[model samples]
Target chain A: MSAKLNATNTLRVTRIASVKTENQTTKTYTFKDARCAKAKPGQFLMLWIPQIDEIPLSIMNTEGNSVSVTVKAVGDATRHLHNMKQGETIGVRGPFGNHFTQNNGNVLLVGGGTGTAPLLFLAKQLATKTKRLSFIIGAKTKNELLFLNQLDPLCTEQPVAATEDGTYGLKCLATQPLETLLAEEGKEKFKMVYACGPEAMTRQVFNLTEKHGVQMEASLERLMRCGIGLCGSCMIGKYRVCKDGPVFNSQQLREVKDELGISKLGFDGNRIPL
Target chain B: MNSNPLSTRLAGLELRNPTALASGILGYSPESLQRIAEAGAGAVVTKSVGLTPRVGYPNPTVVQANCGIINAMGLPNPGIAEYASEIRYAKTVLTVPFIVSVYGYSAEEYAAVAKAAATAGADAVELNVSCPHVKETGSEIGQNPKLLTQVIRQVKAATSKPVIVKLSPNVTDIVEIAQAASAAGADALTAVNTVRAIAIDAETALPILSNTRGGLSGPAVKPIALRCVYDIYEKVKTPIIGCGGITTWKDAVEFILAGASAVQIGTALAQKNPAVFQTINRGITAYLKKKKYRSIKEIVGKAQRN
Candidate 1:
């Protein structure tokens, strides 16, 4: 009757090596983590902030012996995470999920809000693999645009930046350039499009990518618990986003299209309009 | 996959592997159940469904506790009338046995749902007598030996398929309840369900789950569940299907050595992914090879002799 589990399956403590402000509401925390470094670009790690709650944050970047996650203080846990100083430790559980499947060819990357974090990680992985890579990022205002400087060198060409207020790059939404790109090239110029953003923006990406017949994989954000597939909190249709994906290809996205822009299950387990 | 020495039988039901997807974890839809089978579950049990439609408990249904999780998801399901189609759909794709878990407020409702599931092509029926969060449904019917007999008797009479009663760990003496279900004609017994528990927010001093209290599962409840199985095996003749915090192959083997014919895996599926079934199965087979045991039959209840 007496048995012990792999202790590593539970929360492991890691020290915050550094913190850098990404914007007013978000900060990138670099932790001295070796266990979580193996996480793929599209996967997420469950960050347990003591006394708050555990929340899933996309893996922003990983360097030698350290992993970084960009947190937007939209909720209590995120706010507590953003306020943490160096030398403080937090619990980390995973880098769980199926990551973005790399493809060879010219690529288009789209990011919105804090959604840019995982895309930034993906771009870093795809930098050398693709023939040419470009980015189109959007935020409510210029200050909210994440990882612009970090993404600059990674892009094969100049990245397009968009903000609704025209405070940054283009005044139109990020989808405008994508619409124009697909309209101009008709899916021939870029081999695929990778996007991570709000549901509305990602839904638009799904529509435009489908119209253009170009391959697209979008990183989806869903309320998650237990990051493993069991909790059922992160279900988008039959796919448990935590297990099957936080990343879904155009084809897989279509299967769950009914729930994509329609609704999402909330923290209370009730279906709420997206 | 071909049968190996690790193949096990509970009553007349045979499993290619000793690991099954326990009720209430990824058992909702046909596609998810199909994927679980592909991941290597010998059998997959559908989530607990009642006679009528229930949305279960509201948000904050699940939360991570010390070493596992607490969930008060009040058995949310589309009524059996509609879920039967889902069972049929799952049957189309699943190569393994599909066990339907049913719950009701009375013996008649339990028997009705079991009959509906059997007619819908369920290979077997698992009586969910122990969801700790829901009221007058799971634990209420499970904890009483007399009431347990009535429910099991009616269900056994209603369906020709094998009936497996999932017992609760909240009772004082689980062996008494197990003996009653076996004496009443339950084909097999799922040794234990989640223990009653709750989690609180430190800052607010309020219970974390929306339902206030929920059932605790994962590694934390393993020892208690094992003890129940060990205790029940000595008194009951019916085979025991062990569940509760079985995360690894070693965990699964421990349950079998403690007297479980096959073990149902729930919480481990969350952390290790669906592929965990195959990983645990491989580990079990390797252990069998290492110990020179002929089969799982040789291992079941071996601890009782000791």
Candidate 2:
């Protein structure tokens, strides 16, 4: 029962732009739909896999009538999504919840692992606005890091890169470049910061932003059922992250303790309920 | 929306629409009554109430299946005495009529809940002779026409308000049970309750639900409910309140065409969208206007059989 929205139509896959196998367990899928105009950067879609259950995925790219989703085959639905081709049909609903907004300010965009997809979308949107964009991408190793080819085209300044081992740009973490960027500009040149990644990395981002006093927003992850605020499964503390937020302004999280986005978010920052 | 132009009054009560929410699914619990009534649902049914407080089963009163669901909530309630207060509170809050679903194991247990429901200002009472998992009662009383009629007559005798007997779906012939309920002066009949089912842990080979067996509801059981309603509509002279897996307005319209004036939606509220009331309401309004029917009355039981 919906407001005349057919689950089939509301959750249809109109176009599959590209199918890239990034790793053994993960793949990048680009889809375009007229209904995707409602989506924003931090908001997600509930990808319905028919007999299997639905899973939540952040929209990685949004252009004229299309949105892209990068899925990791960790579960049933995600596994099914990884197997689809460029012209296949899938069930997708929403572009649900609030988005990460960028005001007319200098921005620092940070990303990690496959969590880089949303940042890639955000970076292109930010680059068109102003050239003073700081982009940092990181992974555990050279191979584990993804989306380099996509990011190379979008970043005005060279995209900052790092890993735990000395296989890429820096040997520490993505936050290291951000810390250096803060030091070089007397920590005041960047007016805003945003990030999507593992909770640990996001926690570091939120902490650094708190220290720098920059306006910051971080995308959080939580397992969602009805994705529209009915099944009480995707709860983070008090708020239903699906309805209240998946992207929260860093300052607002000061009052929120151990929310689902920061606590239970799995790889790529989607909440996976066990 | 009476299907038969030649309608008979039950115990002197007239039913314009017989589709009512089964007791546990849509209850007059605080703000919920006003919400459901506003949703344009035909009517509201209160959760089952007994003589004392019951905690019911925990954690897994409900389980999911490929088609529907199975739930074994052990008639959890705040008992008749406390429920009377809740019923009073509900009446003041609800704009539409409220039906109280009362359950019991013995003759006096049933009578007590009925008396409490009457005094609490409920518009009517549905004698719940069937709940699959609750031991010592429920379907045991429902499947037997003798017990079914007796329960209806006793509850009807206890209150001046309309009395409806809710029958079990897990029965040989639901029509016989419906006729018996009608003959006993029941004002209406609620066609069915959830069928009993259980799930296993697979690895452990142990029952999954705490109650071992639960009542099935949702889109999965829509067919069974449809069949039950169609079967009973053929024999019952009294109004029939059709329930079971009614989550959409399309489902509601189907029940109406099959000879029910209204419907009750459950399980859908849990797994699909909680904004179910709005969806069902919009669909009903759209269908009504599109079909050019002045009222639900014009199209009820309009299905033609070959």
TM-score of each prediction: 0.76, 0.55
Instruction: Point out the worst 10-residue segment of candidate 1 chain B by lDDT.
Output: B201-210
Which is the leading candidate under TM-score? Answer: 1
Q: Report the C-alpha lDDT of model 2 over A190-234, residue by residue, as the tens digit.
A: 777888888778878887777867778888776554455433334
Docking class of 2: incorrect
lDDT (0-100) at residue A41 of candidate 2?
73
DockQ of each candidate's interface versus the true one?
0.19, 0.04
Candidate 1, after superposition: displacement of residue A243 in Å?
A: 2.6
Candidate 1 Cα errors over 4 Å, as ranges: A1-106, A112-133, A137-176, A182-192, A198-215, A222-225, A236-238, A249-274, B1-4, B56-67, B198-212, B287-294
lDDT of 1 by residue, B37-91 (tens): 8889999998888788776654456666778778887787778987888788888
Name model 2 segments beyond 4 Å from true: A1-274, B1-20, B26-28, B272-274, B304-306
Q: Rate the local accuracy (lDDT) of all candidates.
A: 0.85, 0.69
CAPRI grade of model 1: incorrect
